[model samples]
Target: MKVLFSSWLGEVVDNRGKPPESWSDCPAVTLPDTFGKDRPMSAFIGWGGVVVLNESYDIVETAYKYAQALQASSCAKCFPCRVGTKVMEDTLYKILEGNGSDSDLVQLETLCGSISSNSKCGIGQLGPGPIKDTLDHFKADYQAYISGGKKRPNYHYPYKMTAPCTSACPTGMDIPLYIEQIKEENFAGSMATIREASPMASSLGRACFHPCENNCRRDNVEKSLAICKLKRFAWDYENTHEVDMPLNPNKHTREERIAIIGSGIAGCVTAYNLALMGYRPVIFEKLTRPGGVQLTGIPQYRIPLESLDAEIKFLEGIGVEFVCNVTFGKDETFQTLRQKGYKAIVLATGADLSKGMRTEGEDQGYEGYYGGIGILKKIKYENAEIPKYKTVLTVGAGNTAMDCCRTFARLGSNSYIVYRRTEKELPCDPHEYAESLDEGVKYMFLEAPKRIVAENGKVVGLESVKMELGEPDDSGRRRPVPIEGSDHVIEADCIISAIGQDPDIFYMGDEPKIKLNKWDNPVIDEDTMQVIGVPDVFAAGDCAMGPETLVIASGHGRRAAQSIDQYIRGEEIHLSDEQIMENIIRKIGAYNKNEKVPNPKGWERQPIPICDRDKKLSSFEEVELGYTQEQAMEEAARCMRCYIVGMACVISDSEGGE
Candidate 1:
C-alpha cells in the first residue's frame, strides 16, 4: 500500500516557533499517530457526523460553513439535489448574509428531510445533513440569523456520507493493498495480501458477487476496476508460475479444540483461520464431499472442483481436520460435541436447502418438478435424479437460477428462465446472465408461475401471469405486480423452483434446542456470532443470515473465529469501548514520501477472456479462460486505490464501519 504524501508537499510549522523541518526529516503521519498515545487533542472526533465540542467552540459558524460546503459539493444529479442543494446554499448564505427570514430556516429543514428520503443516491440523501445538525445543536444561531444578528463562534460538524463504498463491502478488504502490490508487479505479494484477509481468495475471485466492486469509487472514472478477476489472476499466477511463500511458523503450544459444522465457505473459512491461529479445528461435513453448497450447488463448469479442493487442501496443510459424511443433529449434537472435549462449536450449516414452489401439485408427488439447487447437486454428484427433460424451466433470476439454467444447457436440455422481474431487476451477476444467454438459454421475464399446469400429476407446463413493475420493494427492485386477466401458459417438460432458500434449522430436530428466532434463522448476536442463549455454540454464514454470498459468509466465518477464541478465553463476546479504541490503527500526520506508487487513472480495464461460446455450450467444463499474465498486470493498473477513503474513518467514535 502506498502512503500518499501529496497532502503535505509544502511547508509545515508546528506550534513551536522554531523553523519547521522538511517532510523527509519528519516521521510519516501514519494511522497510529492519531492514537494520541502521546498527542491526541488536535485529532478531531465526530459523533453522529458532528465534531464533538463544548461551549468554548462556536457551533453556528462551523455548521453554516459546512452546510454551505456540502451544498456546493453535491453532484446535483437528481432534482432534489440540483434544486435542493442550491436552495440550501442560498438559505444558509442569507442567514450569514444578515437578511434571513423565518421561512428560510423552515425551508432549510424541509429540504433536508425531503432530500434525505427521496434522493436517488448518497449525493442528495446526505447533502443536507449539516443543516439538520445545525437545526439541532445551533438553533440559537439560526434564530439569531432570523433576527438579523451575528454569533461569534460557530461549531463545525464532521462530513457525513464519507467512505460509503468501504462501508458497503462485506469483508471490508483493504482494496488498495493488493492493487498497489499488483501495480508494483508483485503478483505473489498481491496474492499474499489477499490471503492475509480472506482464506478463499481463488474461489472468491471466480464466484464472489464482489459487493466491494459495486461500491468502488473508480466507477465514477469509467468502469469499476476488474477487482474480482484480478484476484483470480493473482491466485492463478501463483498456482502455475510462482512458488508458494513459506509462512512464519506458529510456535505456540496451546491446543484448543474448535469444532466447526458444515463444509461450506463459512465452515471452511472458520477452520482455516482457527488453524492459522494454532487451534485444533475439527470440521464436520454432512455430505460425502466437502465445500458445502460451493461444490454441490455451484456447478463445476463455473468454479472447477479442483479450485475448491486446492483451498480445502491448503486448510488441511494448516492442521485443520475434515470429517466427511457426518450429520450434525443425528451423528452428533452439541451434547456429543461437548462430550468430545471441544471447546466451541461453530454452526456453519449454510442455507443448503432448495426452496419448494408451493404451487399446485407441488405438495404431492409432482412429476418433473424439483428444486433448482437439488438438481444442481444431483448434476454435480452424478445422481440418478439428473434432469432428463427436453425442456426445463428455472424459476428465479439469481445466480443459482443461472447456474441451473447453465446446467441444463450442458446437459442438452433447452432451458428457459421464468423471472417475474425485468432483466434490470436480475439478482444474478451480469457475467452469468450474459453467458447464460450466449448458451441459448431463453428468458421469459415479467412473468411468474401461477401454478404447475400439470396433467394427471405429471408436470407438462406452467400456468403463469404477466406482471408489471409498481413501486420499489424492500429489496429495492421494483415490486412485480400481477396484471388482472393476463394469465398465460408455458410448455416445459420440467420445472425447477429457485425462488430462494433459507437455512434448514429443522436439522436440529429438538435435541439440544439451539435457539432460533421467528424467521427460523439461528439467533446469533450480530457482533459476536454467538447463539443468543447457547454460550458454547456460535453460528455463521447462511445459518445466521438466511442466504448471503460467499464473501459475506466467509467474513462471518472470520468474525466467528475471533469471537469463539474470545469466549474460550473467558472474555466478553462484544468488545468494550476502550478495547475497540485501543485496537484501531489511526492514520494521521504527514504521509510518507517513499511509499507513493503510480497513479491508476485512464488505464483502460483489460477484459477477462471468456471461453468460446461454441466450446462452452458443448461441454460442462470451465467456461472462462483464466487471464494471461500480461492481461492481469494491465488490469491491475486500473485500480483507483479507494482505501484512502478508509483514512477518513480515523477519528470515529468506535472501530471501523463494515
Candidate 2:
C-alpha cells in the first residue's frame, strides 16, 4: 500500500523516487501492535505522534482517514470532540477540494484546539495530533489549501468576551461540556458532574432554562442543542436507575444548629449541603409533606411525584432532618429557634400566595377568577372531583399560565390563554408553550383580561381588550398598550389567573430581626442571602428570590449553605473580585482565541417523549415522557468534557520550581 501526499508544500513521503500510495508503504511510521479489541489495525490512520513522526503520513487523505476513524472510534465523551471532529474533517475536505476559504483554515485550527483540550481519553486527546502536526510541520499544506495559490488573511480579531450561555449558569456548569458528554455515551459521568452543582440533577436536566443554549456556538450553526432537556436525560436515568454519588467527607464539624424553613428544593438542598459540612441542620416545612411547591405546586405531569419524593428521600438519607407540618413563624419564632440552641436560620418559604387581578366582581358570586397557586394545589392533591367548567380562560403568559392551561386540558376544560402580548413576548418557554398548544390549549395573544362578567351570580364570560406592543418597558420587554376600538370578549365558565404570585410575610412579625422589602420578600445581603439585621438568618428559594425557577432556587440554597458555613467558621464571607476574574478567564481559555468553527454535524438531538395530543389532554400521566436509557446514552455521548487534566503554570527556574 503506497500513497502520494499532495500539497503545494515541498514535503512528500517518497519510496525511492515513487510517491507512497498508502500509509502502509511507509515502514518508518510506527503502528501500535494492538489496541482496543473493538478497534483494529484497519481503524488506525496516519502517524500518531507530532514530535516523533514530525512529517510521516502527513498526507491530508491519511489525516482524513484518521479523523474519520476517531469520529467513529471516539467514546464520544465530549461535544467538541464528538461533534467537532466531524466538522473539522468536513472543513478539511472543503479545503482539500479547492472550495476552502481563508476562514476555513482558522475554523480547522479552532476545532483542533477544542478537540485537544475538551475531549476525554487518549483517542480524543491524540485525535487532533495529525492535523496540528501538519499545521505546524507542513504549514504550507493549509496555506496552499486556503490561499488558493495566494496568501492568508492578516489581523485576525482576538480577545472576544466570554459567551453568555456559560455566564448565566450559577455553578458554572460547562454547558458545552455535557453536550459533548451526551455525544460520548458517558451518561453516568455527565450526570455526576451535574449533581456536583445541583442535587436535583433530574429536575434541572428536564426543566432548567438553559441560558447556555441561548449562547451556544452551535446556534450560529443551526439551533442550539436543547441543552436543558439533554440535562434532563442524564438526571432521568439517575432517578429511574441506581447511580452512585460518592460522598466527600469533611471531618470539620462546628457545634452549631441551623434551621432551614420550607423543606422545598431550596431548603432541602441547603440543609443537605449543610449536613455534608458537618452542621446539624434541620428543615421545617409548614405542609404535611416536605418539598414545598415541589410537592404542592408542580403538577405530577411535569415533575412526577416519584421523582420529587426520591430526591427528598436522598436528602434525608444524607442526614438532612425534615420537620414537616411545622410552620416556622407560627409554631416557632425566630427568637424561639435561636433560643432553642440554633445558631442560624434559613428562610426558604416559597411564594405560594397567588396574585389576584384585583378587579370588581372578583369576590362576588362569579365562578371565574381561579388563583394560580390554588389550581395547582388541587391537581397535585390528586382529588377525583374537579370543578366542572365548559370553557376556561387563563390570564398570564408565564410558565404558570402554560401549567394552568395544561392542567385545565387534562381536567376536561376547554382552555384559552389571554395574554397582554404576542406569542413572541410570552414569558413561558417556547417548548412548553408548543406542548401546551399541542394539547389543544388555545392562545389569544396581544390581549389582556379587563373584567370577569357573570350572569345571575355565576361566571359567564371574560372581557378583554386588544393590546399593541409599545416601547421597551423597564422589564426590557416591549410594553403592551391597548389598541383603540379593539375590545374583545371571550366566553368562559371559569377564569384562572396565572399572572404571578406574591410572598406572604404576615407570619413574620414587625420586628427588626429581618428586613422586609416593599414587595413583602425578605431583604437580604445579595452575596450571603442572609437577612441584613439577622446575620444568622439566611433566606433562599422562591420567596427569597421573589419567585424564580426550582433550579435557581436550588442554586440559592447551595450558595446560602456555603455562606452559612463561612459565617459559622467566623471566616470572611465574600468572594474576591480577583477570584471572579480568574474564573471568567478560565472559560475564555476554553474557546478558540482565533476564528469560530462550525458546530459538529451528523447527529440529531434526543427527542423528549410526548403522548398523543388527545391522550395528553385527556389524562395527567405526564405529557412529555423522559428519555430512555439508550436515548440517554446517545445524548450523553455529546458532552465536551472541557476539563483540562493538568493545570497550566508558569515555571520560574530562578526559584528552583522548574
Candidate 3:
C-alpha cells in the first residue's frame, strides 16, 4: 500500500518530498486504507508506530488525540502511567492551543520514556510509542502548530481498548479485566464482567473450548492462565453460596414479545440478553428439556445437568419463558409466530443432524446403525434402554467421536475410534483425547470405513480401508486417500457414524424468503445476525454459521439479541464503534505469539481436580472438579493485563467518527 510516511515496527519509509511515482511502499506496516465503506483513513496511531496514509493528515492533532485517548483508557493503577499520560495529554493540548515551546517537546519525550518503562500494563507501556515516533519523525508539524503556522484539522479520532486475549476471543470478552477482578478476590465483579459479554457462564465454563487461553500473554512467561477454569470458579462460587444472580433492573419492562427457536447455547444466550434489555423472549425447544445440544450431543460427564438447569432457571427468573416439545416450522411457522404477535423470530436450531459416513449398507435398516448425535441423544436425553453390544465402533475423530466412544465405554462396551488420519490429526481436544484413552477406548488410525457388514439386516462389523495423507484440504488438514485393495473388516456389533453435522433446516419448510448457503445454513448478516432477505427474522449458532464452538455460538446470540431489539425499536441494525474497532484490531492481528514478554516465569498453571477414575468409566457423573478459591486467585494473578489502545483518524463524516 502507498503511504506518505511510515515508521511501524522499526521499518521506516519516508516519502515526504518524493513524487508519487517514485515513492516506496511501506515495508512492514499493512493497515486498512479505508475506514467503514469508502471513508478514506487519514492515519492510524496505535501501540505500534504511526502510519500516515494520507499526506493531508494533521500529524500534530493526531498525536494529541492519541494522547487524550491513552489517558482516558488508563486504569490509574500506578503513579507513572496515570500521571504521565495526563501530563502528556496536557502538553499536547497546550501545543494545539498555540502555546508550545522547545522545552515542552523535550518534556514530552522524557514523559514517554518514564511511562513506557514504569507502567503497570500495556495501556501505558505501549501507549506512548506512536507519540515518540511523531516527535522523532514529525517534529516540524508540532512546531508549526505551536508557532501559529498551522490550524486545527478537526479530524475525528475513534479509539478502542483491547488485549491479546480479548482480541482473539470470538465474543470480544474483557478477559484481562475479569481476571484482574478475580485477582482482587472480587468474584462477583468478575462474573459481572463476564456477563457483559455472555450469560452462559456455568455451561460455557464447563463445556466451552476456550480460545482465549491460547492467545494469553502469560504463555510467554510460563503456561497460559487457567482462563476457562477460573470462569467456572466464578460461576461455581455464586451458585454454591446460594447468591441470587443479579437481574437487569429493566427486565421485562418492554412489551414486545420475541420468539427464539431451539434452546441451544445460541438461542439461550439470545433470550437471556433480550430479557436483560427489557424485551420478552420465549424459547421454543423440540426436546422435553430446554438445553439443546448441551443436553443431546454433549455427554453428561462433561457438562453436568444441574449446571445447565441452573442457567435455564435464571433465564426464567428474568421473564424468559421456555416452551418445550415445540419444533420450528413444524409446531409454529414464521407466519404463525407473526400471527401470534411475536415481533421477531430467531432460528438457533443448532446443526445436530449427524452426517452419514458414505459406506455400503449404511442406509439399510440395520438395527445397530446410529448417528453420533442420535446415540448421544438416546443415551443422555431419552434415557432409553441400552442394547448390549460386545464391540461398539464410532467412525470419526472429532469431539463428538470422543464423546461417543467414551460414553459407550462407560456403558461397558469395548469402544473403538476409527479414523482416516493419524493421531496427530485428531480434531478433538487434547485433554478429551487423553481421557478417552485412559478409559480404555482404543483408536484405529490410518483406517477409513468402507462398508457396514451386517447379517440378517441386523448388527455386524465395519469394513475399513487403509488410508494415507495427501495434499491439504480446504480445512488445512491433509486429505485422506484410500490405498487400493486394502479393505478389511473390524468386528463390531454396533456402528455409530460421527463424521460431522449440518443444520437440519427442514423446519424452514419451503420458506423461500429466508435464503440459505450451499451448506444448507442460513445466509445472514455477519455483524447483526439478521437474515438477509427477511429483516424481521434472525439466525445464530450452527444454523446461522456452520457448526462452531459454544462460545462462538453465544457470541452470535448476543449480537442477534442486539439486532432484534433494534429491529423492534425501529432503529438501525448495526455494530457499535467498539465492535467496529474490534474487527479492525482483529484484522491487524492482536496476539503476537513470538513477541517477548518481560514478566518473570515459574508461575505454573493450577491443575483442575478430577472425579474418581472408577466413577469416570462406569458412570455419567461430572468429571472435572472446578478450582477452589485459592487456586482461582493464584491463577488470576498470573494475567499480565496486556491492554493496548487502538485509534483511527478518519473523515468527520465516516461511520467510525465520534
Candidate 4:
C-alpha cells in the first residue's frame, strides 16, 4: 500500500517523507497529475511502465536517449534495430528547436516503421515505443511551443552539431543518447541503439579501432569517449543473457535470388543485408564451410568459432542460402550466373592467396615449406601434409605472419618471425602481435631472408641479413637497407612467406570484358561497385580492391549491395564515392563548429576475459575469451553518447520573438 514518486532529476520521495534504500523493492513510485509552475511537474507513470511526459526536458534529447538505450539493448541480429534506431536518433536531433522543420517528423515516422517491422529482437523492435507515443500524445503541445505559443527567449544563437564523436561514426550513431541510456540503466534499450550502425556488437565491442574515441568531446575534459568498448559491453550482455534473433514476418515473400561470392565478413554481411532486402541470397563459397578467412586464417585465440557460428546461423534463419564447396571462377563462371537469372552478383572473395618473396630459394627443395595462406589452410583443415617441424621461420610482420607464428606455436612447433624492418614497423594490429609474443613466438626484427640453406636437399637453416631503417617507402613506413657484413643464419626446418597478396584476377579471363587495375585487381566504379566494361558485374572485398581489413571489406560489401540493387532496378545511379566523401566532409564541417555537449566520466578500459597465456597455448580452444555478461554490462555503462540533440538557430532578438 506504500507509494513513492520519482522526480525527473532522479529524486525519489516516499509517503514516509524519505526514499527507501532499495527503491526497486518499494511498493510503488507514483506521480501527481499537476503541480505549481515553480515546482517540478509530476509526470504520470501509467500502469506497466508506461512513461507519461510532463516536464520541460528537451523532447529531442528525451527521444534520442530512449532510442540510444533501445539500440544498445538490441541483439543486433536483424536489419531494423541494427541500422534503424541509429538513423532515428540521428534524424530526431534536426527536429529539435532551431534546426527543426516539418520534414523531420516524416523522416522519424519512416525510421520508426522500419525498426518496428524488421528488427530482430524486442529490444530494438519496441525501442520506438516511447518515441511514437510521445509524438502521438504531444504533437499539439510541440506545435504550440514551436509556433510562438510561449514568448521566445533572448538567448544568443550558436551553431549546432559540434561533437566529433558523432561525426566520426560511420553509422551516424547517437553516441550521447546511448551513453545517457546506460547512465539511466536502460540496458536493453542501449543495445538496440548501438545495433543501428554496427551488427557485430560483440566483435566490435572487443576489436573496433574506435575512431570515435579519439574525437570524443570528453578528451577536452579528461579522457575520450569509450564508445567502442561500451558497445562491446552491451553486446556481451545481450549475447550472454539469452538474446535471440527474431524471425522475419515477410519470409514467404523472399522470391528474388541474390548470389554473393566469398564467405568472409563481407560476403556474410552482404548476404545478411540482401536477406533483409527480401531477397534470398545464395552465397557461393570455395570451402566446405562458411567464414572464409575469419574461420581459417584468423587464430581461434582472438575470435572463437562459437560466436562466428552463432552469427552465421542467425543469417541462415533469415532466408540467406549458403552453398559451400563451390568457387566462382572454376566451379561456375559469371556467364553461368547470368544464365541462371540471378538478379545480382556480389564478389566478396577476400584475398586468400599469400604473396611470396621474389628472392631466391622460393622454390628450394624443402620437406616443409609453405606460403602464409597455405600454412593457415593446412592448420584449419588439420591436413598434416605440412610437417610438424621442430623449428619454424615466418616472413613479414603483418597480421598474417603473426597468425601463422602463433598457430605454429600451438601445433608444438617453435616459431620465429623474421621481419626486414624493426618492431615499430610491424603491420599487425598491436593487440594481435602482443598476443603472439605471449604465446612464445620470437621476433627477429631488421632481418631479411638472403637464402634458404639446404643440407642434402632438405632445408636446414634460413640465411638472413640485418637491415637498418632507410627512406620512407610508398607505404610511408621506413624501408630497410641491408647492412653489407651483417649476414647471419638461423637454423629452421621450415619457412612460410607472408609478405602480402595480390588479387587473383586471371580467373576473370581475357575475354570477360571486365577491366583490371595495374595490380591486376578488378577495376570497379568505387561508388557503384560496378566492374568497368562489365555492366552487370559487381566487385567487392579484397579481390576487387587490394588487401584490406575485414571491417573495410564489409563496408564495400554493403555499398556494393546498394549499387547492385540500383543496377537491377534499371536506375541511373548518380551517387559516386566522391559525392559520398563530399557529403561526409560537409556534415563534418557542420558538426565541428557547434557548441560542445557535456561528457560523462570515469571510464576504464574494458578487458576481454581470457585464460592464462600458458594455459591457452596448450590447446586451440580460443585464448582471448569473449566478455562475460557482467564485464560487458559494466563496460556498456561507460559510453558517453557524443551527439547533440538540438540544433540552435541564430536570429536577432526581435526576429526570434515573432
Number of clashes recorded per candidate: 12, 36, 0, 30
TM-score of each: 0.72, 0.71, 0.96, 0.68
Note the Cα lDDT for every prediction shown.
0.70, 0.66, 0.88, 0.63
lDDT of 4 by residue, 1-658 (tens): 1233222113233232344443332222333322211223223221012232223333444454456545555546677777787777666544444455566677777777777666543344445654765565456544544453342333222212223565565444556656656666666787667655445555555545565676765565455556766665565566677665556555526576778888887787677666766777889988888887767777666566666676677668877788999978788777788779887777777777778777577787466667898778777644445567899999998878888898888888998999999888888887778888888999988999988887877778888999999999999999899999998888998888899877655467833687677867788887667887777777887887888766566666667767766776788744643234333333323233222434344566566677876678887776655555566556545543332222222223443121
Candidate 1 structure quality by residue, lDDT tens digits, 431-522: 88988998899999999798887888788999999999999988888999999999978998899999898787766654455667776787
lDDT-best of 1 and 3:
3
Which TM-score value belongs to model 3?
0.96
Overall local distance difference test of candidate 2: 0.66
Candidate 4 regions exceeding 4 Å error are 1-195, 202-236, 250-254, 382-386, 576-583, 586-602, 644-658
**For model 3, how does the per-residue alpha-carbon lDDT over 1-658 read when each residue is reduced to its tens digit?**
7888888776788989888888898866667767765566788888878888877698888888899898899989888989999999999988988889989999999999999999989988989998999999998888897788666768878889999888888878899999999999989999999988988888888988888888888898879988888889999999899675787787889999999999999999999899999999999998889998888888899887888898889889877899998977778889999999999999999999899898999889798999999999999888889898889999998989999999999999999999999998999988889999999999999999989999998878999999999999998989999999999889899999999998889977546888788999888889999999998899999999888899999999999999998899899898876777788888877777877889888989998999999998899999999988998998898888999888888877434222
Q: Which scores better on lDDT, 2 or 3?
A: 3
Q: After superposition, how far is residue 298 of candidate 3 from its true place, in Å?
A: 1.1
lDDT of 1 at 632: 76
Error of 4 at 339 (Å): 0.7
**How does residue 530 of candidate 4 score in lDDT?**
82
Write candidate 2's Cα lDDT for 534-627 as tens digits. 7788889887868888777877888899899888889977643322332424432323223243346756666777767666767777667777
> How far out, in Å, is residue 535 in model 2?
0.6
TM-score of candidate 4 on Cα atoms, chains taken together: 0.68
Ranking by TM-score: 3, 1, 2, 4
lDDT of 1: 0.70
